[model samples]
Target: MKKVLLLTCVLCLAASLAGAADTIKIGVMAPLTGAWASEGQEMKQIVDLLGEELNAKGGLLGQQVEIISEDDGGDPKTAALAAQRLSTQEVIASIGTYGSAITEASQNIYDEAGILQVATGSTAVRLSEKGLQYFFRTSPRDDDQGKVIARTIMEKGVKKVAVLHDNSTYSKGLADEAKAILEEQGIEIVFYDALTPGENDYTAILTKLKAAAPEIVLATTYYPETGLLLRQKKEMGWDVQLVGGDANSNPDLIKIAGADAAAGYLMICPPVPKDLPSEEAQNFLAAFEKKYGGTPGSIWAVLAGDAFLVIAEAIKATESTDPEELADYLHTSLKDFPGLTGLLSFNEKGDRVGDVYRVYTVDDQGNFKLLQ
Candidate 1:
């Protein structure tokens, strides 16, 4: 009798484990431990919150959602390995590996495996131009952002402009687009060059820019380099309007550049939607602040949230976790997902369908304020 009871318990345990294994796993590949670690961590948090919310609402397709997060270290090789690992784990869909270079490097692995990839922040237009059916982006491409930035600069009455980029795929792409647009608008691009991102000093580049006497200096760089450039430019007394791409919209820029130097620094990025266009946006902001203990550190957080929401909704609508089926649903059925950032929908190329970029500037209080 004792042996029969023990056998029964063992069988029940195996069944429980099998049930647990039937969860819907969503993989997150991001820079969780390198230069872009902060943003990666933010992405992880957003995914976690999404999983929690989905589980609370009786889960997706009657199965609990599980997030499998991997650190890509913001490097191409690392991103490729991460992608392979996630694909091997059989995650239904994956998000991130933020920078465009890393995203490009890892995309082939995901594409070959038929895994769906939803990019949260990689904005290089080439990603969409590749005609990959399995890939999609929740963020606007650099071409869209570049037009907005160039038009904003021209509208601000800035004629002579200098363009600088960090040479990363994201930064250089935006710089090139902006350069073309500015030139087409008859705006003189006095100085244009790319800088290595981690260089300690940019005084030499700043000196050249100072000599160029551009009324506006547009830098396409990440936060760390942007902070250093802004500080050095201020110390050099270069009296030009300093503007940058979405990467500079982080609070760390102000922390690194100091309040005085960071003030009036403009960035073109997806608006944070202070007015809360939808109840979902309002609830997300409140819940994010309550759970995370502060406002989102960057717009990447908002994009990450939207990416997860879109993927989750697609899974629920399709009622299947099959990667190919989910990708088809995402491409065809997912439309106008009222995301925290804005209305979210993908075009035929898997790029977000609408323009969401807005001009933001650091106020004297060292906070980002939308410029109407």
Candidate 2:
């Protein structure tokens, strides 16, 4: 009787272990509770929705898909801790992180642990230049956006411009990129400076920028600061055109600045899902609306969905969760995978291939209208 009992116990333990291994774990690192919480929360929602749909279709490799999310809090130090936690959980891949610095903090951890990482919104060019084999992004780089901004300014016949940044890695990189291109194109840069972000008032900065008397101000900062700058500028009765970078592509900008103040503001970014012409994107928008009650407020979150799609496709094609195999497939084999953003492919440097930036203007009612 004792021998039979021991044998049954061993069999049950084996079965339990097998059942536990019957799922694939994916990690999500995002700023779930900080200044960028809205973007992060939407990232989680999109990923979760996609995971559910995938499982409904029989899951990946015949196993249920599991998502392990870690909050980066939009800070570098917090992101490092999140990355460390995710690395220990045996996740085959991780997607995430809006801020460039926050993503950078977690890059080494994932790379060292042999986990594939796809950054959704960190557009700093140097993130891919580091030669980390596991690092990739679904978003375009800063240099491409800089050229677009410069071209738009030249098209507008704006000779004098003020370039401003928030001193963050991504913001400063974009500001410098656009500034260099403008100078090369013979556009006069009347003022160039970095402003402190997260402040409710930017009147001092506005006064200084107005004194410079530029026809347009290219503000390379997030939506929060951009909204304040626009409102404050309008309050000061300055009518200078404020051209924002991709970071300002959130609806909250209009709310913060108010429609009257936000009217006529221009920005350059990848088209949101509604603007994407792909049938897959349209389907995604419909499903997202039906499930979540509305479309995503920012393109960054959609990029997170793209990151998930890319990882899922790589897994499906390779049929293996080994990071090396997945990374190799993405770097070499994956090409023109239809994503919510566009036909997605990664170059040798791990940056998304193609220039998809479009110019948009805010109307009086705060709607973002594509200009060109």
Candidate 3:
């Protein structure tokens, strides 16, 4: 009787191990706590919701899909560690580490492990330029956004501009690109500087910017710092047009800077899908609002959903989760994927192909209006 009982225990344990082996694991890396935690939380929520939907429809390749999420704290070193840990856990692919600097810092680890990484938010052009075989982004690159911003500024008859960044990989890359495009268009850059993120005050920087008297101020930083800078600019009574990168498009900017201060500030970003021409996009917007209890607080939510869809589609098409095969399908076959954000496709360099950017300005009510 004792021997028979022991055999039953062994069989149950073996079955448990086999079931675990049959589950498809995907890694989710994001800043669950830190300056970017709000955005990261939204991304995580979208991924979790999508995972549930996929499982409800009979998961991928006859296996249950599981998302193993890790918090990177929006730090590069932490991102690398998270990537290393996820690689060891048999994740077929990983998504995120939102900031470009963190993603760049962690790419080598995923590359060495041959794990596909779909970047949901990182937009530094160098991310794709690094020839990383396993790295791809659902977001548009900074250069594309820069061009749109430059053209918008030129159209506004702004001849003198100031460029500022938070010295982050994403901010600096977009700032530099915009500066170059502005210069090429014969616009004088009166001031170009980098600010340390998380600083309590930027009065001194605003004083210097006042001296330059730029007609337009272009900031390529995340919301917290961008809000601070804009508020300071207003308090200092520096009259200038303000514009920023995609990161600055979040509603939190108005919340931080106050509706009055954020009013009339423009941002170059991917078009929000709420009223887009795509019927699928409209459905996604409605479903997301219904499930999440609000409109998405940031674009990261949309990109996160798109990243999940892209990965699931590849898995379904290839009928395998092997990283190499998945990467091959993404590069060669994933075209015109009707993502919530847009029609998605990857170029040879792993950047989204033919992305469209729009210029938006904050209205007095803290709502975004597409620039006519």
Candidate 4:
């Protein structure tokens, strides 16, 4: 009798172990602190919200969906380390490495580990190219947004333009792409300046560009830098039309630069929160408001929500929590999934070529409203 009971106990233990391995773990990568903190934190929150939503729906594959979040601090080395550690934690997949530099730094580690990664925010064209089997983005690449910047400026009848970027890989590539497209139309790029990031002022660059008297200044950069550029330009009384790529489209751009400084700036970016038209978007927006007391206030966070939906949908489709299988499901199923961003599909190089960039202008009250 004792021997038979022991055998039964061993069998139950084995069954439980087998059941436990079916559990799913999802990792989220973001800059939870530092200059990019607010954006990253927002991303994490939405991801958690989605996970909770999934759990409420009876979890993934009969096992609870567990999410692990790691802060990359917007540093490349740190992001790489975080990815390595998350790999050790046995996370099936990871959702981000927010900036281009961070993504570039960590892509190899993930690919070598056979871990699939989808970046919520990274938009550099180089991030997905070069045969990195796992790297994917919901955000449009530099090439796509760059052309939209040029097109919007051209449509606005700007003939003479000055282009400047922070010289980061992401900014430089986008600025160059826009330059190429605008130059084709004979818009006449009066000045193309490449400055370093982290600088609190760009008075000299603004002054030189002002001298050139270009009708438009296409500043390709993230929020902090763009805010500084706009503020300094306003201080210098340079009235040339200021525009930015997708990165500067966030509403915080105005707050950072101040209402008086950031007013009248044009942004080529994703659609505003009010305009997002899908049930998934509404669910995300409602959850965000319930948790945070307001809706998504920026493009980055909105994209983050969409990224969560992307992963969640994959979990539902694959019925297996393995990253490779989930990624395959994601790539195949995302093509037709209805979401706030639009129809999602990756091209030959894993790039988002179908993203729509809404043109926005900072109004007098320091608000970025969609420019019809």
Candidate that scores best on TM-score: 2
TM-score for all predictions?
Answer: 0.93, 0.96, 0.95, 0.91
Backbone clash pairs for candidate 2 read none
Give the per-residue lDDT of model 1 (tens digit) for 1-372. 999999999999999879767798889999998878888998999889978988998888778888999999989999999999998887878898688998998888989988889998899989999989889989899999999989889888977999999788899999999999999989999999988888889999999888988998999998899999988888988757788988876788888888888989999998753544778887877887899897677778678888898888887787777777877887877788888887888877888898888888988898889885
- Candidate 2: lDDT over CA atoms? 0.92
> Model 4, 233-349: lDDT tens per residue?
888777777889877756677877899898889988788776777776777788789988987676676777666667777777776667777666665656756656777776656
Give the C-alpha miss distance for residue 204 in model 4, angstroms: 2.3
Error of 1 at 350 (Å): 0.7
lDDT of 4 at 370: 79
lDDT of 3 by residue, 227-295 (tens): 888788888887587888888757778888888888899988877555466787677667777898877
For candidate 1, give the lDDT of residue 250: 73
TM-score of 2: 0.96
Question: What residue runs in model 4 are displaced by over 4 Å at the alpha carbon?
Answer: 1-22
- Model 1 TM-score is 0.93
